[model samples]
Target: MLKLFEIVEDKSPKDRIDELRKDIERYNYYYYTKNESLVSDIEFDKLLKELEELEKKYPEYKIENSPTNYVGATSLKESKFKKVVHKKPMLSLNNSYNITDVIAFTERVEKNIDSVQNELEYVLELKLDGASISVTYENGELLRAVTRGDGVEGEDVTENILAIESIPNFLKEAVSLEVRGEIVLPLSRFKTLNEERLELGEEIFANPRNAASGTLRQIDSEIVKERGLDAYFYFIVDAEQYGFKTHKESLEYLEKIGLKTTGVADLITDMSIMEKRIAFWEAEKENLDYETDGLVIKLNDITLWEEVGYTTKSPRWAIAYKFPAKQVTTELLGITWQVGRTGKVTPVAELKEVELSGSKVKRASLHNMDEIIRKDIRVGDRVFIEKAAEIIPQVVSSVKEVRTGAEKEVVVPTNCPVCNSVLEKEDGLVDLKCVNPSCPAIIQGSIEYFVSRDAMNISGFGSKIVERMLQLHYIKDITDIFELHQHKDELMTLDKMGEKSVEKLLGSIEKSKSRPYSKTLYALGIPFVGKFLGDVLAKKSKSIDVLASMSKEELLEIDGVGEKVAESVYNYFRDEKSLEIIQKLKSFGVNFGKVAEDKKDEVKVEGKFTGKTFLFTGKLQKFKREEIKDLIESLGGTNLSSVSKKLDYLIVGEDAGSKLKKAEELGTVKILTEDEFLELTKE
Candidate 1:
C-alpha cells in the first residue's frame, strides 16, 4: 500500500510524480480491472492529488499514461466483445477544483476567443460519475454501444447497452449519427444492489461508479437489465454534420430524437451568476438520484468549439469545475447517540467544524454501531466524511494512518442515551433499539414525524413547539395534538406562544383533522410504512378499525405491499397501545377514513378547462397550488409540473421560473395571466 507521508523529500518533483503515476496506474488497474482495491479511496486520492499538482509544476514530464489523462477508467474491456472506433473521438474535460481555478479557466476562454466574459454564453452540465459510452443510430435503428476507451476505440457492448431502460432502441428522427452519454447507477438502486449482495453473500461494490462500470462489462445482458443501468446523452459526433450549431441545440436535438438528456442546461454570461449556480448545485446535488461529481462548463457556441478545437485529448471549449470532493478529512471531537421515532439508536459525529461543498458542517451520521466498528472510527481520530446526498453528512472512513495514541475507541452504549433503558437488538438486525415505548426521545420524535409535511402537515407546529409542549406537560401522545385547543391559555404562558401564534397553531391542528386518512396512517409512524404504503393501505382498508384488523395475507393482496410492510402494519395496528391511541383520535373527530372533499363535482358540465392540459408555476395569489390542481382535476382538466410541446395552456402566476420560458420557447402553448385564468373559470 502507498502512503502520502512516505514520499521522499530528496527526490525531485518529477521523479516523485513518475513514481506516484506508476503506483496509481497499478492501483487503478487492480481496483477497476480486478475489482480488488489495495488502498482506501482517500489514500488513492492523495496520490492522484499529488501527481496532478506535480504535473502542473513539471508539465513536460507528464507522460501519455498519466492517470489524470482519463475521465473515468483508463482501461476496461471484455475481449469477447468486438471493438469499434468512435465517429469523432470522445473527449474528456480539464478539471477545475476551486473558484480561482474556474476564474483562470474563464480568463483563458476570454483570451482565446478575444471575447469579453459577458459576451460568452456558457452552459453548465452535471458531470455524471460513471462509465462513458458512445452509441450510434442509423436511420432510427441501434448500431453499437462503444465504451470511451482511451478516448479513441472502445469495446462494443450494444447487446448489454440495449437493455438499459432509458436508452432508445430506435431514434425518433431516423438520423444516422452517434450520441455520447454517461451510464450511471442511481444511488437508490445502488443501495438496493448492495443489500441484495449482502443477502446473497457476495462481494459488495465499493461505490456506484464501480457498480455501473462493472455492470456494463458483464457477459450476460440479463444481469445488466436486472441492475437497471440508465444513461444521459451529452454530445453528438460531428454535430455540425447533423445541422446543430450550438451545444444547447445539440442537447435539444438529442431529446427530440427520443433520447433522454439530463434536465435543461443553464446558460449564463455573468461569472457571478455562473459561480452562484455552481454553488447552488453543489448544495443540491445530493437531491439527485444519480451521482454527479461536478458541473461541466462549455462554451454554448459551436463556432467557438471549432476554433477551440481538440488538444489530442479534451475539447478546449469545455472544462469541468469539480465540486469539493465529497470526501474530506476532519477531526472527530466525540460521538452522540440519538433515538429516533422507531427507537433506533444512531451515532452522530461531533466534528471539528469543516466546510463541505459550500456550508460549514460540524456533524455527520455514524448510522449504527456496526458502521463504527466497520470504519474503526474513534473520538480524536482524523476521519473522512462526506454528504451522502449533498444533504446527509456521512462518515466515509477513518484516518487510521494519522491516528495518535491519544485517540480512544468509541464505546457502543448498551442502554438508550436519552433515557436509561436497556436496548434490544432484534435477531439479524444491526440496530440496537430502545424498546421502551414510553421513552421521551421516541415520543418526541414520533410527534415530530406526525406533524411533518408528508405526514399530517400541521403548520406552525415545529420541533421547538413540540419540545416546549413536552416540557410543559401539555401533551403526552399523538392523540393529544387534536385536543390542544383546551390548552390555549396554558400554551400562551410559554415563550413565543402569544395569542396570534397560539390561534394559528391550534387552527393548523384543527385543519390537520381534515387531511386524508392516508396521511394519518403515515403520521402514526407504523414501522416500515411510508406515505406511499399508507396510500396503498388506505386503498385496501377503508377505516382505521378495518386497518387494525387487517391480516398479513390480506395486506399482501394490495399491489406493492410486500411481506415486510404487511407484517409491520399488521403488528402495529393490533398492538393495544396503538389501538387505544386510534380510539382516542376517532373520539376526537379525526378522519377515520378518507376525508370527504368539500367541493361537489359538476357532473356532465362543459367548459374551456375540460380536456385541456394546464401547467402552473410560481405563487398563486387566489388559490393554493394543491387547491388549483384539485379544481383543475374536478373540471376535467389535467395539471402538469413541466412544459412540453403537447401542453395547451400555462397559467402564469407571480415569480414564474424556467418552465414559463420553456413554454414560450415551444411557442405553441397559450400563456394565461391569473386574471385571465380567473375570468375563464368564472361561472
Candidate 2:
C-alpha cells in the first residue's frame, strides 16, 4: 500500500531495484521492530520476489545487506534489552502458497541428495501465526530468550518469556540446548484484550499475532503477564548434538523435557497423504484456540538436512505452505456514516465485491474519521481489506501505488446523517457522537434494545414491528411499550394484526414488566452498562430510584463500576428526558424494583444448576443463546464470558470452535450437548 516510488514505463531496472530494497527494508522495520504490519504478507512477498528477480538479472545492482538476503530487520539501536548473538543463525523457511511448490521442494531435496533406497519421510506441523523467538537452556534451567532479529542477532526477552506459564522455567533433563518456537496469544485471550482496550478508547490490535508481538516487546513484564501469552517449541538449534536422528525425534525430546510442542503433527511417507493432510488442516485450523496461517513441511530425516543445506535467508530442507490470501484490493466506492444506539458515529466503506477467505465481502468498516485520514483512503481509490481474526472485515490500507487524479478525499460530516443534528466530539476520544436525544435513529435503537431478549424478554417486538409502530406515531419512547394496550383496537386494524395477534402482543408487553431489576437496568440502554455491569449495579443499588439518587462518588464506591460507567449512569438519571420517560413508565405500571425483590424470593437457589458456572458456544437449535442464558440464571447458574478453570459446564452446539477445544484441554469442564443441557434443566 505504501510505495517507495511511482511506477513509470521509462523507469530503469537499477532504479526500481533500489526502490524495492528501500520499501522492503521499511516494511521489515515496521513488522519486526515495531510489531506493526503496514502491508499484507502477499504484498510484502510480491515486492521481495520482484526485487529478487531484478537482483538476479543485474548482478551490478545486488547488495550484501538487501532484505532478500536477511531473515528480518536488525534490532532497534535504542532497544531496551541487551543484544544476544544466536549460537546458530535462525534462518527462515521458504514460503510456498500452493501445493505444487511444496511438492517441488521435496523433489529438489531428493535431487540434491544421493539416490534414496526408500521413500522419504516428511513431517507436517501447523505454521503458527505469531512472533518468532529462540530460548536457550543451561543445565535444564532457562538461561535466556531472544527474538528473531536479523537472524544473526536478537534482543533479550527473558523477562517477558518467564511470564508465560506454558513455557517451563526448568526443563525435565539437564542437557544444554537452544530451541526455537513461536510466541502467540490465544484467540480467546486476544478477543478479551481487545475488548478491554476498546472500552478504554485505546487502539485495538489488528490480530492475535500483533497482540502477542507487542506484548512480548513491552518494557514492563507485568503487562506481558496480564495478556496471557503462550509458546510452542518446534525446532532444536542443533539436533545432532542432542543425539536426535530425525526431526520427529527432536520434537519428542522437546516434549519429554517438559516443553510444549504443537501437539498436532503427522509423519507421512507419501506426498499425496501430505497434500490430503494439508487440505484437512485448512478447514480444521479454524477450530483451534491459536491462529495458524498454514502448515510447515519439513524433511523427517535430520541427517539429510545438512546435505540439503541453507540458502542465504531460508533453509532448503523445509518450506512453509501458506494458505490462500485473506486480504484483497478493491475499489472504494463510498463511505456511509452509521449511528449506533450509543450515538457513536462510524464510517462504513462500500467496496466492489471481492471474494476473500471463501466469502464475498462488499463492505468493510473504516472505524472512524481518524482512520480514514491516517490511511489516506479516498473514494474511487483502490483499498486493501482483510477479515480481522477471520470474523470482522475491515479496511487495512489504501493502495496509493495506483491512485488516480479522479480520487476524492473522504470528508467528515459535521451533523448526524439521519437526524440532521450537530455532532459532538469528546476530548481524548476519536469518535464523534450525536448528542441529540430526540434523534429518530437514537430513539428507534433505544426502543429496540429495551424489548430485546436479554433486556425485557418482550416477544412480538422485532425491529420491523418497532419501526412500523414508530411510523404510525403509536410509540415515541420505551414507555409507549407499556401503554400499547390503550391502542389495541387501533393496532388490530393494521396489516397482519388481527385480534388474537394483537392480544398476544399486549400480553408479551405485560409479561416483560416482571423481568428482574438487572434486566431492567440493562434495557435502559445506558452506555457501557452491559449485562454483567447491569447485574452488579442492580445487586449493589437494590432499586432504580436509589441508584438515581446516589452521587457520582457513591456510584464509584459500588464494585465493578468504573469511573466512565459511573459518570454515564450518574448523568443519565439527571437528564430531564430520561426522568420524564421513567415517570411515564411508572404511570403505566412497569416494574422498576418491587417485582425484582419478590422474584428473588422465588428463585430456584437449590436447583440442579445451583453453584455452577456455564458457557455456551457456537449455534444452538432449540433455544436462542440469550434465552438459554436467562434460563440458566433463573435456575441459579452463572453464565461466564469465556472459558476458564472456574467454568463447570460448556454447552456446545453445531460448529463449536476454540471455546470447545479450550474447555476440553482444561479437562475440568463438563461438555454437554443441547439435548443433554435440556435434560438437566428438567425438574
Candidate 3:
C-alpha cells in the first residue's frame, strides 16, 4: 500500500508520478464505475491536485489516458448495456471555491472573445450535485440516454431513464437534439431509501448523489422507478445548430419542448449582481429539496463559446463556483457509547469543537465498530468530519498523516456502558445491543420516545422533564407517565414547577389518555413497528386483547406486516413485562381498542371523499395530524404514506417541504388547503 504521507525524497519524479496515477485511477474506478466513494471529496481533490502538479512539473511523465485528462472512469467491461459514443464529448466544468477565480475566468473569457462586438452577459444556474447524463431525442421521440462515462463513451441507460417521471419520452415539437442534464435523487426519497436499506441490513448509500448514480445503473428498472429519481435538463449539446443564440434561450426552449429544467436561472451583465446572487444562494440553497454544491456561471452568448473554446477536460467558457467545503479536519478526543430505546448501543466520537456548514459540531457518529476499524480512526488522531445532508455530523475518515505515537486504538465494549450488562450482537446485524431491558438508558430512551409527538403527543413532556422525573423517582416507565397526577404536590415543590405549571403538566398527561388507539400502540415502543404499521395493526386486530392473542402466522397474514415485523410484534405481546405494562396502561383509562361503529365519530365507507387518496405534509395549525387522518378516514378517503403519481390530493400546511414540490412536479395531484379540503368534504 502506498502511504499518502510517505517520504518521497528517495523516489524519482517518474516513480512518484506513477504512484499518484495508480492511486487516482483506483479512486476513479471506485467512485465512477462502482458508485462507491473510497475517500472524501476533499481528499480526492488533494490527490488529483498533486497529480496535476506533478504532470505539469514533469510533462514527460504525462500520458493521454491519465486520470487528470479524462472526465470520468471508463464504462465497466462487464456492463450489461451496450456502449454508445457521444456526438460531442461531455466535458466537465472548471471549479472555483473563491470569488477571485470567477473574476479571473471572466477576464480570460473577455480577453479571448471580441468584446467590441458583443456585450458580455453571464447566466447562472444551480450546480446540482448528482450524476451527469446525456439523452438524445430524435424527431420528438426519446432515443437513448447514456451516462458520462470517460467523456467520450458511456453505457446505455434508456430503460432506467424511462422510469424517471420528470424526463419526457416525447418532445412537444419534432426535433432531433442531444441534451445534457443531471440525474438526482431528491432528498426525501434518499432518506426513505436509506431507512429501508437500514431496516433490511443492507449497506446504505453515503449520499444522494451516490444513491442516484447507483439507481441509474441498476439493471432492474423497477428499482429505478420505485426510488423516484428526478432529472433537470440544462444544456443542448450543440445549441448553435438548433438556432439558439444564448444559453438562457436554449434552456427556455428545452422547457418549451416538455423537458424539465431547474427553472432557476439569472442572466446578468453586472458582476456585482452575480456576486450578490451567489451569496444569496449560499444560504438559500439549504431550503431546496435537491442538493446543490455550487452555482454554474456560464457565458450567456452561445456564439462566443466557439471563441473561448475548451480545455482538455473542462470548458473554459464556464466555471463552477463551489461552496465552502463541508468537510473539516478536527481532533478525535474520545469515543462514547450511547444506548437507544431499543437497547442498541452506538459509538459516537467526541471531537474538538469545529464549525461545519454554518453550525458548531462537537460530536459525530462513528456508526459502528466495523466502521471504526475500516476507517482506522483512533483517539488523539486528526479526522475529517462532515455534516451529512447538512445535518447529523459524521466522521468521514482519519487523517493518518497527523497521527502521533500517543494515539490509542478504540476498543469495542463487551458490556453495556450504563447498566454494566453483557452486550450481544445478533446475526446478520452490525449493531451491538444490551439485552437488559431494565438499563436506565434504555428505560429513559423508551419513555422519551413514548411521549414523542408522533407517538402519544404528550405536550410539554420533553426529554429533560422525563430525565428529571426519573432522577427524582417520580417516574420509571411509560405507565408512570399516566400516573404523574398523583405526584402533583411533589412536582410543584421542584424548581421551575409552580402550581400552575404542575397543573398544566397533569392536564397534558390526562389528555394523552384519549389519543387514538394507533398512537397508543406506537407509544409502546415495539421494534420494527412505526406509525404506519401501528395504524395497520390497530385497524386489523381492533383491540389489544385480540392483538396479544394472535400468533406470528396470523400477524403475518395482515397487509404491510412483514416477517420481521410480525415476529417482533408477536414476541412483544407474549413478553410478560410488556403485558404487565399494557395491563397497567389499560387500568389508567387509556384507549386500547377502536371506537364503536355506532359512535358519532365513526369512519364511513362511502362518503364524498370515497376513492380519493390524501397526504399531508408540514406543520398543521387547525388540526392535529391524527385528527386530520381520522377526519379523512371518516369521510371515506385513504391516507398515503408518501407522494406519488397515483395520489389524488395533497393537503399542504405551512412550511410544506419536499413532498409539496414533488406533488407539483407530478401535475396529477390536486393541492388543497385545510379550508378547501373541508369544503370538498361538505360537497
Per-candidate total of colliding backbone pairs: 1, 0, 0
- TM-score for each model: 0.45, 0.43, 0.45
**Model 1 agreement with the true structure over 260-297: per-residue lDDT tens digits:** 88874999888889889999999999899998989999
* C-alpha lDDT values of all predictions: 0.77, 0.80, 0.81
Candidate 2 residue spans exceeding 4 A from truth: 1-325, 595-683
Q: Which candidate achieves the best lDDT against the true structure? A: 3
Q: For residues 467-567, what per-residue lDDT tens digits would candidate 2 score against the true structure? A: 88899989998988887888988998976566776777788899888788878888988888976678667865567877787789767655456688889
307 Cα displacement, candidate 2 (Å)? 54
Model 2's TM-score against the true structure: 0.43
Better-scoring candidate (lDDT), 2 or 3:
3
- Estimate, for each residue in 577-674, the C-alpha lDDT of model 3 and write its tens digit: 99999999989989889644543223335687866888886656677666888788777777765567668999977656557777888899999998
- Model 2, residue 383: C-alpha shift (Å): 1.7
Q: How far is candidate 1 from the true structure (C-alpha RMSD, Å)?
A: 24.6
Worst 10 residues of 1 by lDDT: 596-605
